[model samples]
Target: MIKKPPFVVLSKISDQIARLETEVAVASPTLANVYNDLQCQIDVVVANLEPLQTISGHIEIVERSMETILDFLSSSGDKSISAANVYSLLEPLHAKIHQQGEQLRKIV
Candidate 1:
């Protein structure tokens, strides 16, 4: 049998997940559980697309970012981090960084 492209398989899985999520919404108290499970399953599948070294590098960056964020928050004294700071400033900066990283990766 001819093998389908990975995107085809992933698209089918995505459709199935959409259906499952709808079912979960109808039967469960909240959708967060379904979303978390779907995210984990997708992560497992996507891990196969990258080398272990690359995956570990990305993971290290995320780990370091979490540590740095926590450290800053802890040492900020009376200064505070607000949702506005995150949503208005940090998140957009993060998105730009990720977009640039993805563009550069595509060039390689």
Candidate 2:
């Protein structure tokens, strides 16, 4: 059986929550109370899902920085770029990539 991706699952769950919220507005007092409790549970699920989204974004940034660094190194040919010069050129990108990786690790 094929499983749905987490974001897709979360989106569907969010849609159902929205529908339930609408129902809550017109529900009886008892039903509305039940819906409110369910809403709190759903809120927790959504909160957990947020970290997954944040990690995905951070991974994209790390990938982009890695590509940029690769491109920079690949294009360095006859240029007598010293080690210090190369390090200086790549340090910011390296720092950004490392920061994103650290953020992802924390999220995980």
Candidate 3:
């Protein structure tokens, strides 16, 4: 199966984040060399964000896979494992995504 390109979209996001960071710094602070600092921080943040987005995508795939497995388990004549375990694994992932989303919202 053909899968979507993950990093390509992320690269665009990184560029946007970098541009915003630079713009924010240049527009604010009103200090000498503030642009340099803004660029640095933007680079740091974009670097951080790219990986987080990748992780988020992976988590989504995992959740879907888990759901599929649960479906298969239910369909067959077997009930060895409970779906709760899959949900339990997803709890932390869900929380992390929510937290990151909040952080991103604050940026926008």
Across 1-108, the per-residue lDDT of candidate 3 in tens digits comes to 765555455456556656665667666745425545655665666666665566667667767866876677668665565569767766766787676677667555
Over all chains combined, what TM-score does candidate 3 have?
Answer: 0.44
Regions of model 2 farther than 4 Å from truth: 1-5, 17-38
Clashes of 1: 0
Q: Output the better candidate (1/3) by TM-score.
A: 3
lDDT of 2: 0.74
Relative to the true structure, how large is the alpha-carbon lDDT of every model? 0.64, 0.74, 0.63
Judge candidate 1 at residue 80 and give its lDDT: 66
lDDT of 3: 0.63
| Candidate 1 per-residue C-alpha lDDT over 11-103 given as tens digits, one digit per residue, 9 for 90 to 100 | 578667766777777678478476658856775665554443464466567667767776877798788678776575457447655855775
> Which model, 1 or 3, shows the larger lDDT?
1
How would you order the candidates by lDDT, starting with the best? 2, 1, 3
